[model samples]
Target chain A: MILVADSGSSKCDWVLINNHGEWVDKIKTEGLNPLLLSKKNISNTIDKVQHLLNKKHDSTIDKIYFYGAGCGSSGSGNLIKDLLYTTFNQAKYIRVEEDIIAAVHATTQEPGVICILGTGANCCYFDGRRVIQKTPALGYLLADEGSGNYFGREVIKSYYLKKLPLDLEESFEKEFGADLNLLLQKLHNVDSPNKYLASFATFIFKHRQHPFIENMLHQGIAKFIDSYLLNYKEELLDSPIHFVGSIAYYAQDVIKKSLDERGFIVKSFIKKPVGHLVNNIINKNIL
Target chain B: MILVADSGSSKCDWVLINNHGEWVDKIKTEGLNPLLLSKKNISNTIDKVQHLLNKKHDSTIDKIYFYGAGCGSSGSGNLIKDLLYTTFNQAKYIRVEEDIIAAVHATTQEPGVICILGTGANCCYFDGRRVIQKTPALGYLLADEGSGNYFGREVIKSYYLKKLPLDLEESFEKEFGADLNLLLQKLHNVDSPNKYLASFATFIFKHRQHPFIENMLHQGIAKFIDSYLLNYKEELLDSPIHFVGSIAYYAQDVIKKSLDERGFIVKSFIKKPVGHLVNNIINKNIL
Candidate 1:
C-alpha cells in the first residue's frame, strides 16, 4: 500500500491507495506546513489521523508520498521526514515534494501549464515528466494573485472601504463580524494571517450572485492571468491549462470565462488533486 | 519645546521645534511599528535617538507628537506613548497618531485628498480639520497597490521569470545576490519580510531609467490610483491630490503623468513629509 497526500497552507488531504490503484481509505487534517508547524505539532497531527489507517494494513504500507507547501526547502522537508519516520517506521520508502509539483502531476500527464489557486497561488510549466519552467510565486504576502486568500483579502478591503453595496456589506458584517479594529487585530497580532484572511472566502462564495462579488472574482481571475499565467503565454495559450485548488474549482465558471476571453483552453479544474495523484501513482507503478 | 515625528514601517523622521516656530534639531531612526517590535526593541530605539535631545533641553521639552504606521489602534499607540514616557520622563504631554493623519496634515491644510506612497500605500480625504472620508489601506500584504514594496515585488517576479532585459537582470542579481533559493529563505524564514522586500526598492530606484523599470513604476502608480484614488472619484477629482513618501518623491514624473491623464491636479510631492508636518504643527499649534 502507498500513502498519498496533498497539503496546502490551509488544509491537507490524504489517501491510502492499494497496489490495484484503488483508494482504500481517505482522511483530512489541518494544514501541515513544515515552516509553520513544529515537529511535535506535526507528530500530534499524524497521531490524530492514524486511527483512519487500518491496523492490519499499517505494516504493509511500504511507501509514503508526501507533497505539501513549505516542504520545498531541505530543512523543512527533513524535519517532516524525521517526524514521519518516528511515527511510521514501517514505511521504509518516503518521498517528499513541493505542492506545486504534486499539483502538476495530479492535473496533467501531458506537457502544459499547471496553476494552483488555493490559499496561495503558484504556477509552473510542466512537461509530461517534470516541471520545465516556473514563475516565482512570492507567496501570500507579495503575490497570491487569484486565490481564496486573494479573494478574502479583497473582501476585507471592500468591506472596510464601503465598496460593496449596502446590503452586501450588512451581510458581510453579519458573517465575519469584522470591523477595522478587529480586522487589524487578526491581521497584525495573529500567526496565521493567510488563513485568517482566506476564511472570508466563504462569505464571498456564499454571495457569488452579488454584483460586487462577481466583479471582484473577475478582477482576481484577471490578475491571476496577468501575473502568473501570462508569463507562460506561448505554451499556456496552445496547450491545455490545468487548475487545481478550491478557488479554481469553486470559481470554475468565472475562471473559464476569463480564460476563454484570453484565448486559452482550461482542460481541467480539480477541487482536490490527491485522488488524481493516487491514480497516477497506480497507473505508472513507479513506486 | 515640541518634537514632531512621522514614521512608517521603514524609518521615522523626527524634528524638534521651539516656541518661536523655528526648527531646532532633526534626527532619523529605524522604523518602529508597535505591531512588529517588542517593548525592548522600541525602548532600545528610543535610547538610540535620545541623545539628539540635549540634556539641557530635556526638562524644557514639554511635548512630543508622534504619528506613525501601526499606531492606528489605541493599544499600539499607548504602547509607544508608554515607551516614550519612560524615556522622556520630563515630557508632560505625549501624543501618538496614525501616519495617514500625519500625511494629511503635512500635505494639506484645506479640504483635499492625501496619499502616502511609501513602503506601503494609503490615502484619505481631509476636511481641513479632520479626515472625513477615506479608503482603507490593507497594508503591504493584500493591498498596497502602489508602494515601494509593491514595486519591489514586481522586480523580484520579473527577475525570476527572466522577463527583465538582460542588462537589468544582471544588475538586479548583482545588487540583491538573490536566486530563487535565497529569495525563498529570506521570505519564509526571516522576520520582517516587509523590510526585506522593501530593501530591494533601491534597485528599482537606481535603475528607474530602464524602460522595464519605468513601465513597472507606471503600472504600480496606475494600479494605486485605480484601486485607491478612483474610489473617492467625486471628491478627489475637484480636490488637489497631494502625495508623500519615497516612492511618490522619486517617481514624481511617473506619478504626475498617471495623475494628469486621470484628470487630477497635483498639489505637491514631498519626499519627507516631516518638514511640512513641522510647519503644520507650528501654524496650527494644536499641541
Candidate 2:
C-alpha cells in the first residue's frame, strides 16, 4: 500500500492507497508537530496510528509521503522523518515536505498562485513544482493574515470594542465571559496564541451573515491576495489562483466574491491536497 | 486671580478667572501625568504655564484648582500637587481628583453616565458629586472598551483581513504598511498596548465618512453602552446617558443615533468638562 499523511499543528489526515491505484483506507490521528509536541506525544500519536492501521489492514505499508507543519526547515522535517522511519520500519521510501508544498502540488503544479487557509495561513506563487515567491506566514503573532486566526482576532476586537450587535455582544460575553484581562493575558502570554485566536473563528463562522463579519472576511481575503499576489505585479496578474485549506473550502463563495471584486479569478478550491498528492505520488511511482 | 486648570492625558487647558468670575487669560501646556511624565517633564509643563502667565499678564497666580490625569491615585496626585504647590506658592488651595470627576462635574452631575473617549476610554455612573460605580478602565490590554484605541484596532483587523476597500486598503498600506508582524509585536510587546492601539484611531478620524467606518463607530458605541448600561437590565431602563470626550464631540450624531436606537435619552454631549468643572468650582467655592 502507498501511504500519504497530511499533518498540521492540530490534526493529521492520512490516506492509504492500494497498489492498483484503488482507495483502501483512511485514518485520522492526533496532531504531530515535532517542534511543539514532545517525544511522548509523538509516540502516543504513532501508537494510535498503528492501532488504526492494525484494525484496517493486515499488510505493512511499502512507502509513505508526509507533509506536515513545522516542516518548513530541513531540521524540523528530518526530526519528523526520523521518528516516523523508526516506527514504520517496513516502509521502503519516506519523504517529508512543508505542508505548503503539498498544497501547491495538489492545487496547481503549473506556474500559478496557491494559498492555505486553515488555522493559520500562507501563500506562494508556484512556478511549476517550485515555490518562486513567498510571503511570511508568521503564525498568529506576525501575520496569518487571511486565515482562521485573523478572523478570530477580528471577532475578539469587535467584541471588546462593543461594535457587534447588542445580542451578539451579550452572546459572546456569555460564551467567552466579560473578563478580557484574563482572556487577553491567556492569548498573549500563553504558549499558543494561534490556538486562542483560531478558536474565535468559530464565532465568526457562526455569524458569517453579520455585515461586520462579512466585511471582515472580504477584507481579510483581499489583504491576502494583495500581500502575496498583487506584490508580484505583472507576473501574478494573468496566472490562475487556487486555494487549499479548510477555510477556503468552506468559505469559497466569500473568497470568490472578494477576488471577483478585485478583478481576479479563482481557478479552484480544494479542501485538502493529500488525496491528490497520493494519486500523483502513485502515478509517478515515487512513493 | 483664581487659577483653574483641567488636565487630561494629552494636554492641559487652564483659565485665569478674575474675581469678577470672568476669564482674564488662558494658557495651554503639555500634558502632566505623574505616572508617564517625569518630574522634569512636569516642571517643564509648569514652566510653560508660568511663561504663558508672565508673557500675557505679568502677574503671579493666587489660588489654584488643579484636576488632572494620575490624580485619581492618591500617591500620583500628591506628587503632582506637591510639584505644583511649590512652583506656585501664592496659590493656597490645589485640589486634585480623577479626570472623570471633572468630566462629571462639568456635565452637571445630574445622575448620568460619563465617558472619556480620547486615546483611551473610561466610563462611570455619576450621581451629582462623585462617581458611584466604575467599570475598570485598565488601558488597552485589559479594557478600553469604547475609545479611539478600539476603533484603531478594528481598522487594523479589517485592513489585515482584506475586508477594506481596495483603495482604502492601498491607502492604509501606503500609510501604515501591511507588516502585521511588526504591528503585532509592537502592540503586544510594548509597555502600552493602549497607546499602540489608540494610534490607529487617527485612521478612522481621517475616514469617518466611509461607510465601513461609520458602521464601526455606530457598532462600537452601541457595544460600549450595552456593556456599561444595558447589562444592568432593569436599573438602566430609564437612566439618562451623556458623553464627554473628543470622540463624543466629533461623533455626536452617531453617538446620539446609536443611543436612541437602544432606548436611551442622551442628556448632553460636551467636548471637554474642564470648562464646566471650572464653573462649578467657582459657583460652589468648594476649592
Candidate 3:
C-alpha cells in the first residue's frame, strides 16, 4: 500500500493506493504545516483521522509521499517526514516535498510558471526538467501576495481600520461576529492562523462583486504579478502560467485581467491538485 | 514654561519654551512609542534624556505637549502621558497626541492631506481644526505602506528571497551582515522591531538609484496612495498632499510622480516636523 498526502495550512487530503495501483482509501484531516503546528498538535490532528486510516494495512504501507506548505522553508520538511513515519509505522521509504511539487506535477510538465494561491501563495518556474524560483518562499508572514491568507488579513484588517464601506462593515460583523478582541485572540491562540485567516474567503466570495472587493482583487493580483510573475520575463509570454488553488479558481476573472494586461497566458487553474497528482505519481511509477 | 515634543518610532525631539515663548532647551531621545514600550522601557528612555532636562525649570514647566508614533490607536496616549508626568513632575497639564498632528501643523494648517513616512507610515486629512483619517493606524505589521518600516521590510525580504540583483545582494550581505537566522532573531527578540526594521532605510537610500530600488519605491508609494490617499476622493487634487519624514524627503521624486499621475499636488516634504511644529505651537500659544 502507498499513501500520498497534500497539505496546506488549512487542511490535508490523503489517498491510499493498493498493490495494483488502484485507489483504495481516502481521508481528510486538519492542516499539518509543520512550521505552524507543534508536535502534539500534529499528532492530535492525525489521531482524529486515524480511525479512517486502513489500520490493517498501516504496517504494510511501503512508501508514503507527503507534499505540504511550510515544508520547503523549514530545512527540508523533516518534521512532517518524522511525524508521518510515526503515523504509518512501516513506511520503509517516505519522501516529503514542498506542496509546489504536487501542484506542478498535477498541472503540467511543460516549461511555464506554476503558482499556488490557496491558504498560502507560492510560485516557481518549471524548465521542463526541474524547478527554478526567482525568489525564496518566505511563508505567510512576509509573503503570500494573492492568497487566501492575504485576502483574509486584508479584509479583517480593513474592517478594523474602518477602511471598509459602511455596508460591507456591517455585513462582515454580521457574517463573522468578528471584533478586534476576537480577531486578536484567534490570531494569538489558534494553532493555524493561516487557516483561520483563509476562512474569510467565504465572506469575500459572498461580496465578491462589491466595488471594494473588486478593487482589492485588482491590487492583490497586481502584487502577485509583480512578485511572482514578472521575474520570469523570458517565459512570461512564451510559456503559459498555471495556477492551482481555491483562491486562483474563484478569482480567475481578476487574475485573467491582470495577466492579460501584461500579455501572460494562463494555461490551467486546478482547485485541488491531489487527484491529478496521484495520477501523475502512478504514471511516473515512483512507488 | 512649555515642552513640545515630536516623536517617531525611532526617535523623539523635545523643545522647551520659556514663559516668554523662547526656545530655552532642546533634547533628543530614543522613541517613546507607548504601544511598543513597557513602562520601564519608557522610563529608561526618559532617564537617559532626563539629564539634558533643565532641572531648575522642570518643576516650573506648566505644560507638556508630546506628539509621537504608536500613540494614536492605543486609547488616548495615556501611557506616555503618565510617564512624562512622572519624569517632569510638571506643575500642571500634559497633552499627548499622535505624531501626525505635528506633521499636520508643521507642513500645513490648510485642507491638505498629511502623511508621515518615517519609521512607520500614517495618513490623514487635515480640515484645519482636527485630523481626519480614512483608516485607523494599524502599526507596522498590518500597515505602514511607504514608510521606513515598509521599505526596510521589502528590501530585507527581497534580499532573503534572492529577488534582489546580484550586485545589490552582495552589497546587502556586506553592509548588514544579515542572514536568515539573524533576521529572524532580530524580528523575534527585539524590543522595537519597527525601529530595527526601519534601520535598513540607510541601505535603501544609498542604493536609491538602482532600478530595483526605484521599482520598489513606486510600488510602496502606490500602496500608500491606495490605502491612505485614495479614500479622500473628493480631496484628491483639490487640496495638496504634504509629507514628512526622511523617507518621504529622500523619495520625493518617486512620491511626486505617483501622486502626480493620480492628479494629486505635492505641497511640501518636511524631513523632521519637530522644528516647524515647535514654531506652530509657540505661534498658536498652545500652552
Candidate 4:
C-alpha cells in the first residue's frame, strides 16, 4: 500500500492506496511537528501510528509521503525526513515537504493562489510543478492574518473590550475566566502558541454571524490579502485562488465575501490535502 | 485656599493654591474613579485628603474643583459630588466635571481637539464652554483608539510574531516570558485589563526609537485619527489640536507625526490638565 500523510500544527491525516490503484484506508493521528515535538515525542507518535495500523490492517505499508508543519525550511524538513526514515524501515520511499505543498497539490496547483489557514497560515503562488513565489507566514505572532490564531486573539480582545454581548461574555468568562496573565503564560511558556490561540477561534466560529466577529473576519481577511496575495497582484487577478483548512470549510461564506470584496474568485475549498497527494502518488507510478 | 484635583485611573494629583494664587502644596494619592472604586472607596480617598489637609493649618478648605475619570456621565458626577459633600463639611463649593474637560481646560479649550491617553483614552472637540461634539470613549475594549492600551496590545503581537529583533525579543521574553496564555489571563481576570495592557506600553516608551515600535505607534495613531478626528474633516482642519495625557506627553513625536501626515497642526502638548483647569475655573468665576 502507498501511504500519503498531511500533517498540520494540530493533527495529521493519512490516506492509503493499494497497488491496484484502489483506496485502502484513511485515518488520523495526533500532530507531529518537529519544531514543537522532541525526538522522543516523535518516536512515541510513530510507534502509536504503527500499533494502530497493525491492529486495523493485515497488508504491509510500502511507500510513504509525509508533508507537515515546521517542515517549511530545508533544515527542519531534513530533520523530519531523517526521523521518519529511522522509524519506518519497511517504507520503500519517503518524501517529506512543507504541508503547504500538499495543499497546493490537493488544489491541483492549476496556476492559482493556495492558502493554509489551520492553527497558523501560509500562502503561495503555485503553477502545478512548484511554488513560484511565497511570502513569510511569520507564525501567529507577527502574522497568521486569516488563520485560527488570528480568530482566537480577536476573541480574547473582544471579550476584554466588552464589545461582545453579555451572554457571550458570560460564556467566555465561565469557560476561560478572563484571566490574561494565565492565558499569556500558557501562550508563551507552552510549545504551541498557535494551538493555544486556535482554541479560542472555536468561540468565534460559534458566533460567526455576530457583527463583531464578522467585522473581525472582514478586517483579518482584508489584511491577509493585503499582505500576501496583493504582493502577487498580476498573478492573483489572472489565476484562480483556492483555500485548504478546517476554517475555510467552516467559514466559507466569510472567505467568499472577503474574496468578492477584493475582486478575486475562489475556485475551490478542500479541507484535507492527503487524498489529492495519494491520487498523485498512485497516478504518477502506475499511469 | 483653592483646591484643584486631577483624578485619573491610576492616581490623583492635588494642587493647593493660596489667596494670592501662589502654589501651596502638591500631593499625590491613589486614584478615585467611581466606575472602578466603590462609594466607600471614594469616601476613604476623600478622608485621606482631609486628613492630609488637617495635618497642616486648615481653616475650612474652600473652593474645591474636582476633575475625574467616569465623571463624564451625570450619574457618576453626581455620585462623586455627593461623596465630596459628605466627606468635607468646611468645603463651601465643589465643582465636578469629566476628566476630558480638565484636558480641554488644560489646553485652554482653544477651539481644537483634546485627547486623554492615560490608562484609557477619551477625546473631544472643545469650544471653551463645553464639548461641542463628542465621540464615544467606550473604555479600552470598544475604543481607546489612540491610547496606551492600544499600543501595548500591538507590542505584544509584534513580540509574538518575531517582528522584533533578537535582542529585543530576549529582553521581552526575559521580562514578560513567552507564555501568552498567562499574559492573556492576567489581562482579562485582573482588576483592570486597561491598566494591564497600558503597563506594557511603557516598554514601547523605553524603545520609542526602534523602527518596529515606531511603525506600531504610527499604525495606532493613524487608526485613531481615521476613526475619530478624521471623520470631522472640516473641524479638524480649521483648528489646532492639542493633547493632554502621559502617552501624548511621552510620545509627542509620534502624535505630531500622526497629525502632520494628515496635515493637521498641533497647538500645544500638556503633560497634566490641572493648570488649564485652574485657569478655566478662575476665568469662569471672574467672568
Candidate 5:
C-alpha cells in the first residue's frame, strides 16, 4: 500500500493505493502546513487517521509521497519530512515535494510552463522530468496572482469599496453581509484570511456577467499572466501552457479568453490534478 | 474653551478652540471609534487626554464637538457622548456627529457633495444647513470607495502578488520586508487591519510614478468616482465636489484626473479636516 497527498492552505487530499495500483481508500484531512504547525501538532493531526489504515495496512505501507504549499522551502520541507517519518515509521520510503512539482508532474510529460491557479498561484518551467526554471510566487499575500485568493481579494475589495454594480451588490449583501464588521471579523479576527478571502471567488464567477466584475476578473487574470506566465514567454510560445487548479477550471472561459488573446497554446486546464498526479505516479513506475 | 475632534479608525485629531474661536492647543491620541470600543474602553481612552486640558481649561470646557467615523449612528453617538459627558461632566454642551459632517462643514457652506475619503469613504448632499440627501458608505470592508484603506488594500494585494514591477518590488521589500508573514502578522495577529492596510497607501503615493502603481491608483480613484461620485451625478454637475481625506489630498492628481475626466468641479481637497472643522465651528457664528 502507498499513500499520496497534496496539501494547500485550506485542506489536504489524501489517497491510498494498493500494490496493483488499485484504489483502496481516500480520506481528507485539514490543511497542515509544516511551517505553520508545531511538530506535535503535525503528529497529532496525522495520528487522527492512524486507526483508519489498520495495523496490516500501516505495516504494509510501501511509500508516502506528500506535496504541500510551504514545503517548497528546504527548511519547511525537511520539517514535514521528519514529521511524516515519525507518523509513518512503518512505511518503506517517504518523499516530500512542493505542490507546484506535483502540479508539474500531473499536467505535463513535455517541456512547458506549468501553472497552479488554486488557493494560491505558482508557475514553473517543467522540462518533462523536472522543473528547470521558475518564477517565485511570493505567496498569496504578495503574489497569488490569478489564484482563487487573488480573485477573492478583488471581490472583497470591490464589495467593500461598493464598486460592485447595484444588482450584484444586492446579491452579495444577501449572501455575505451589508457591512464591513462581518468581513473584518472573519478576515482579521479569525484564522485563515486566505480561505476567507478566497471564498468570494465563487461570488465573482457567479456574477462575471457584470461588466465591473468581468473587467476585474480580466485584469486579475491579465495581471497573473503578466507577472507569472509571461515570465516564460520564449518557451511559452513554443510549448503548450498547462494550468491545474480550481480557479482555472471554473474560470476556464475567462482563462481561455486570456490565453487566446495572448496567443498562447493551453494544453490542458484541470480542476483537480490529483487524478493526473496519481496516474503519473503509477505510469512512471515510481515507488 | 471648546474641543473639536475628528476621529477615524486609527487616530483622533483634537483641536482646542477657545470661546473666542482662537486655537489654544492640539492633541492627538489613539483612535476612538465608538463602534469598536467598549464603553469602559472608550472612557479609559478619553481619560488619557483629560489631563491634557489642565484644570483651568478643563473647568472652562464649555463644549466639545466630537465628529468621528462611527458616531453618526444614534447608538454609537450617544455612547461616545455619554462617555465624554462623564469625562468632562463640567462641560455645558456636548455634541457627537459623524466625521462626514465635519468634512462637509470644513469644506462647504453651500449645497454640494461632501466626500470623506479617509480610512473609509462617504459622501453626502449637504443642503448647506444639514445633510438633506446622502449615500450610505458601508465602512471600509463594504464601501470605502476611494479612501486610504481602499487604496491601501490594492497596494497590499499587488505587493503580495508580486504584481509590482521589479524596481518597485525592490523598493517595497526594502521598506516593508519581503515576506507575507510580516504583513499577515501586522494585519491579523496584531490589531487594526484597517490601519495596517491603510499604511500602505503612503507606499503607493511614494511610488505613484511607476506605471503599474499609477494605473492602480487611477483605477481605485476611478472606482470611487464611479460608485460614490457618480451616485450624485446631477448634483455633481452643478455643485462642486469637496474631498477631505489623506488619500484625496496626497493623490490629488489622480483624484483630479478622475474628476476632470468626469467633468466635475473639485472645490477643495484637504488632507486633514480638523482645520476646516474648527474653522466651521468658529466662523459659523453658532455652537
Candidate 6:
C-alpha cells in the first residue's frame, strides 16, 4: 500500500492506494505543519491514526509521500522526513515535498502559476516541472494575501473599526463577542492563530450575499492578483492559472470576476486537492 | 499628594504633585493596559510600585488622575479605577480617562485634532474642552493605524517579503531571526504581541535614511493620514493638529510633511505626555 498526504495549515488529507491505483482507505487528521509543530506533535498527529493506517490495512506500507505547508524549505522538509521515519518504520521509501508541488500536480500538467488560499496563502510558478516562487510564504503575519486568514483578519477589523454593515456587525457580534478581550485571545494566547483567524472567514462566507462582503471579496481578489499573479508577468499570460484551497473554491465568483476584469485566465479551482493529487501522482507512476 | 499618570500600551509615566502644583517625584512603569490585562495582573503591577509610591514619597496620596490606553470604554476605565483603589488605599479621589485626553491636554487647550502615535494609535477631536471621537480607539489588532505596532508590523513584513535592502534584511535577521518558527512564536504564544511587533520598528528607525525605509515610512504615514486624519476633514485644516507619543515625536518630519502637503497645520508633538499632562491638569485645578 502507498500512503499519499496533502496538508495545509488547517487540515490534512490522507489516502491509501494499491499498486494498481485502486483506493484502499481514506482518512483525515488535523493540520500538522512540521514548521509550526514539534517533532513529537507531528509524530502524534500521525500516531492517532495508526489503527487505520496499520491495523485495518494490514499490508506493509511500502512508500509514503507527504506534501505539506511549511515544508517549502529543505530544513523543515528534512525535519518532517526524520519524524515520518519514526512513524512509518516499515516504509522503505519516504518522500517529503512542499504543498505547492501537490497543488501543481493537482491543478495542471502544463507550465502555469499555482496558488493556495487555505488557512494560509502561497503561490508558485511551475516551469512545467519545478516550482519557482519569487516571494516566500511568510505565513499569516507578513503575508497570506487572499487566504482564509487574510479575509478573516479583514472581517475582524471591519467589525471592530465599525466598517461592517449593521446586520453583518450584529451577526459577527453574536458569532464572536463584541469585545476586545475575546479577540485578544486569537492574537496572544491561541495555539494556532492561522486556524483561529481563518475560523472567522466562515462569518464572511455565510453573509457572502451582503454588499459589504461582496465588495470586500472583490478588493481582496484584486489584491491577490496584483501581488502574486502580476509578479509572474509575461510567462503568466501564456500558461493557465489554477487555485487549490477553500478560499479560492468559495470565493470563485469574486475571484473569477476580478481576474476576468484584469484579463487573467483561470483554468480551475480544486477545493480539496487530495483526490486530484493522488490521481495525478498515480498517473505519473511515481509510486 | 496628587498622582498623575499617562500610559500607552508599552510604558506608563507617573508623576507626583503637591497641592500647590509642584512636582515631587517621577516614576516610570511597564504598561498597564486595563483592557489587555487581568485584574490580578493590573494589581500586581501597581503593587510592585507601592514601595516607591508610598515609602519613598512619605505622604498621604489624595488623588490619582490616570490617562491610559485601553481605557476609552467606561468599563475598562472603571476596571482600572477599581484596580487603582486596591493599590492606593489612602487615595481619596480616582479618575480614569482615555489616553487621547492626555494627548489633548499635553498638546493644546484649544480645539484641535489630538493624535496619539504610541505603542498603539488613537485620534480624538478635542472641541476646546470635551473630547469628540467619531470612531472608537480600536486596539492594536484591528486599528492602531500610524502607531509603533503598526509601523513595526509593516517593517517585519518588508523584511520577510524580501522588500528590504540587503543590509536592513541582515540587520533584521540578526535582531529578529530569519526563520519562520521564531516568527510563529510571536503570532501564537507571545504574551504581548503589541510590544513584540513594535520592537521591529526600531530597525526601521535605525535605517530611516535608507530610501526603502523612507519610502515605507512615507506610505505608512500616508495610510495613517488617510485612515485617521482625513476623518476630521475641514476641522482638521482649521485646527492646529497636535500629536503625542514617541512614534509621533520620532516620525515628526514625515508626518509634518505629509500633513503639510495636505495643508494641515501640525502644531507640536509631546513625546512623553506624563509631565505635560500633570502640568496641564495641575493648572486646570481638576485635581
| Separate DockQ for every predicted complex | 0.40, 0.04, 0.22, 0.04, 0.17, 0.34
lDDT by residue (tens digit), candidate 4, A6-73: 89988888777787878878889877776666678777877777777778888878777788976776
CA shift of A71, model 1, Å: 2.7
Clashes of each: 0, 10, 0, 43, 9, 0
- Leading candidate by lDDT: 6
TM-score (0 to 1) for chain A, all models?
0.91, 0.88, 0.94, 0.90, 0.93, 0.96
Candidate 2 global lDDT: 0.72
**Top candidate when judged by TM-score against the true structure:** 1
TM-score of each: 0.89, 0.53, 0.74, 0.56, 0.78, 0.83
* Winning model by DockQ: 1
Assess each prediction's global lDDT (C-alpha) against the native. Answer: 0.81, 0.72, 0.81, 0.74, 0.77, 0.82
Q: Interface RMSD for every prediction, one decimal?
A: 2.7, 7.7, 3.6, 10.0, 5.3, 3.5
lDDT of 2 by residue, A150-199 (tens): 77777776776556889889879888888755664465454445666777
lDDT, residue A175, candidate 5: 89
Kindly list the per-residue Cα lDDT of model 5 for residues A1-287, writing each as its tens digit.
88898887667888888888887878888666664455676777677655567643644776888888767667777888887777777877889988888888788788988888888888889876668544565565445777887788777766654467789888888988766554554654334556667898898888877888889888888988888787788888789988888888887888889899889988899887777888888888744
**lDDT per residue as tens, model 4, B1-287:** 88889998777888887767667888888777766566887888889987898798566677788889767667778888998888787788999987887787777645887777777677788765658544545555335766877777777766754457887788788878887545644653454556677778888877777787777777888877766666456778677888888888887888888788779898888887776666666665521
Considering the two chains of model 3, state its CAPRI-style docking category: incorrect
B52-169: candidate 3 lDDT, tens digit per residue = 6755454477788889887774453887888778877753888988888888989886898888888888888988777887666667756788888888888887887668899999
User: Candidate 5, residues B57-115: lDDT per residue as tens digits?
Assistant: 64478789898987766767888998898888788899898888888888888988988
Residue A16, model 3: Cα distance from true site in angstroms: 6.4
Could you list the chain B TM-scores for each candidate? 0.92, 0.83, 0.95, 0.89, 0.94, 0.96
Q: How many Å off is the CA of A264 in candidate 1?
A: 3.6
Per-residue lDDT for A155-236 in model 1, tens only?
Answer: 8878876678999988987887866766776676555677788888878789989887899899999988888888888887
Error of 5 at A40 (Å): 10
- Put down candidate 6 lDDT per residue, A167-194, tens digits, no spaces: 9989988999887655664464455677
Candidate 1 chain A lowest-lDDT run of ten: A50-59
